[model samples]
Target: MNLTYLPLFYDLSSREQRDALNELMARNPAIQLIDNILEQIQELVRVLFPSETIGEENLKQRVEVYLQNVDLATYGTWVYYPWLEKIVHLLNEEDFIRVRTSRNMYKIDQKEIATLGKKKIGVLGLSVGQSVALTLAMERTCGEIRLADFDHVELSNMNRLRCSITDLGINKAILAARQIAELDPYIKVRCYTDGATEDNLDDLLLVGGKLDLLVEECDGINMKILSRLKAKEFQIPVLMDTNDSGMLDMERFDLEPDRPILHGRLKVLEGLSSIAIAEQLRNLSFPEKIKYLSEMIGIENVSDAMKRSLPEMNKTIVGWPQLASSVMLGGAMITDVARRVLLGQLQSSGRFFVEFADLINDDPDKDFCRS
Candidate 1:
């Protein structure tokens, strides 16, 4: 497989060069804020390799030689795009390269924000959904994003949505689009000033050539239902990370042809009771969770029956202490799942909740109600 990856060993690789750059940034954080960042990266790459096809094993030695006496102020930024160069120049060099957990993680690298070239994401529900979108933007992950929302930003949303005083009264989708473009001019944004629905959901999910992922955080119960179905029908995994009183629901759906049915409409077609089956499926999961459901309903393979009934595979968080605690657990776990998905790791298809609170009492982090 042509692994779509930043070759880890590539140090005398981009990995090592990032470390050298990180060292410089560590010493001087407030470096021009925008242009200095890229300038430094270019400087490290040039100094380490000097030529494009330089030997891989010798990169570290060359980098160590270049840093014998380094000067950040003298670096130039002509190689990287002007917009990225400008944005990077504004940061304190040190702050830009700091890794979150350094002790165990083998590589301490400043991830090139996902949108260096161009990528798009279709996000629903601007409230918590906005959080996911902004987090992506802040990291400079995607190149383009299509934001859909029918609601306007209101005072209540200030509790969780990312917006400022000046952004009030604007439609949530448009507002989110503006935030993304503003944070990084390199980002090209499209807004669905209209709300999302089954009618237009197809256009949004299948549009823009490639939707890296679809994040569902919408409040409309039916729209939420449609979003998941469309994601499955389109073979796009859907990610829903939410916070309730204290727990976070992290659902994963990998559109599968081997499953039962994709959505309720099929059940309606089959003359099978969807509401009843959905209620049943919603309470079952893997054999274990299925067993848990069986214990409750007095039957085995409950979820398997539901899955056999449903026929598709797809993948898909939130909290409070009763909400706060779940929120923390959900938020934390979703990142783990997302990284796995982004990196092509194994993740089961279905709903998952990280009941963090159970840790103190000895219950495992696995608990479920399926559908």
Candidate 2:
């Protein structure tokens, strides 16, 4: 089933766009038409005057004033989502963004939002990366997001991935792009279905203006190392979440151009050229890859449950186990850190954990009123 995720925008004022819209409607007579432009304009009016508390009649008057008494049907742009066979009417880009992100005011501030709108973020894997990408879109954290993943959705992935059952067998990267488009069609998205590799690494990081930040989540040990090498070469910061124990890795290659990838954990790969590193890692047995992965992520820092689960892989279990809770937490953590990093509010490189297991007390006998 071929599908296109990008939404098409039309300005009816233009004769060309008007004909295109007419042709689209004629071609797909069953397409769903959704026009909520009036409500959208009402919300936009409230956003424009956030300090005031206006009644429903007053709000309607304000909306009319803002629209200059223009007819609501022709006031804004028409966006069509081909995948869903639906067309929606909403305020144009600038006003839509302002109203959509109105609640982020002061917390993100107008200046910071503008800055974020100019930033581009790259995500290499879709398992946990989907959460990060969607979070970034919902928060309007960045203007463009690049996704790369060669894998397809499977029933087993439902435990952690936020995708519908109908998406099974769909490329993960494409699935994420579709989701992002459905949420906010304005955010730009590019998918690398081949996944990040030695050949595409440079293009992914440098092609469309070097990525401001790279979130590396792919499972391949080689790509993990190679992607960072490319990011370091381009002086781009990297962020990663292991989807376990709330572990997050931030490599400020932008701030410290000389910093070793993964904090020098995989020293075996230090001296080899990118090609040699790929070849060498490609020949490693499954056990060897796991060994290197443990070293890279610090086996000592792994949670007790994960350490136990690792030994049962391909035996009692299929592969590494990940929970929905951990994946959600990872998404939140990475997005928060990403916003801070992009805004220049955070500048450091190291591993951090927001371990819920450590923060909560399970003891039933603890005092109730202690300070």
Candidate 3:
């Protein structure tokens, strides 16, 4: 099914555009109309005047004061989503962002919010990346997000992916873009359905403008290496989540251009060109590929469960297992680290862990009431 994720906007104050909206609605009688601009304006007023104590009556008065002489009907813009056959009213971009991120007051202050609004992020996969993208959108961490994935949703992917059954067979990147549009239509999203490869990696990382940061999560070993090579070439920092034991990887290519990829663990392929590396990895057998992957993410550092599961791939299990809980944790960790890196709060680059087992012991006979 062909679908468009971007929403159309109409400014009621403009007679021509308003007439077009009316004409379109008249033609499509089944289109669902949603008008909550007034309530949104009320929320905006509350956010604007945090110090003022406002009840329902005073809130409306505050909205009127902020609107001045502007009519309630034309104060904001109307947005239409083609895929859902629905139309909604929302505040224009500026005020919409202001009220949406109002709760982040002291934590991400006004100055940091503005700074983050101008940053762009590129995500290379959609499984765990889906959660990361959604969290970033909900926090309004960046103004633009780019997604790249060559795979489609599958029934098995539901174990960890945040998608409906109907989304099966849809490209992962496109599905993520639609979800983000529904959440906040103002954020910019670009998709690379062909996935990241040597040919298109440049376009993905440098086309419109160089991305401020890159998040690599694809399954291909070749892509895992190629993407980092390109990121290092452009001096863009990279982040990744291994989806096991809360393992997170951050490579500050931007800060240390000389830093070897994957902390120099794959030093065996150090001198090879990108093409040579791709060809060599492609020729490797299944076991060889796993050997290289182990090098990429320290084999010794992975959980004991993962270590046992690796030998069972295509045997007892079709593939390495991933849990929804671990994926959610990875999303949260990556999003937090991304914000810190972009905002200049975190600088060092290395592997880190936020394992739950460490925080909550699983001993069967441990005292439960110990303080």
Poorly placed runs, candidate 2 (over 4 Å): 363-371
Q: Which lDDT tens digits does candidate 2 get at residues 336-358?
A: 99999999999999999888766
> Which runs of model 1 end up more than 4 angstroms from their true locations?
1-119, 245-255, 258-335, 360-371
Ranking of candidates on TM-score, top first? 2, 3, 1
> Residues 48-141, candidate 1, lDDT per residue (tens digit)?
3434664544555555565466544433211222212212332222322222112212321234222222445677877666766766665444
Enumerate residue pairs that collide in model 2: none
TM-score attained by model 3: 0.95
* Worst lDDT 10-window in candidate 1: 1-10
Deviation (Å) of 305 in candidate 1: 32
Residue ranges of candidate 3 with Cα displaced over 4 Å: 363-371
Q: What is the lDDT of every predicted structure here?
A: 0.49, 0.89, 0.89
For each candidate, give its TM-score against the true structure: 0.52, 0.96, 0.95
Output the better candidate (2/3) by TM-score: 2
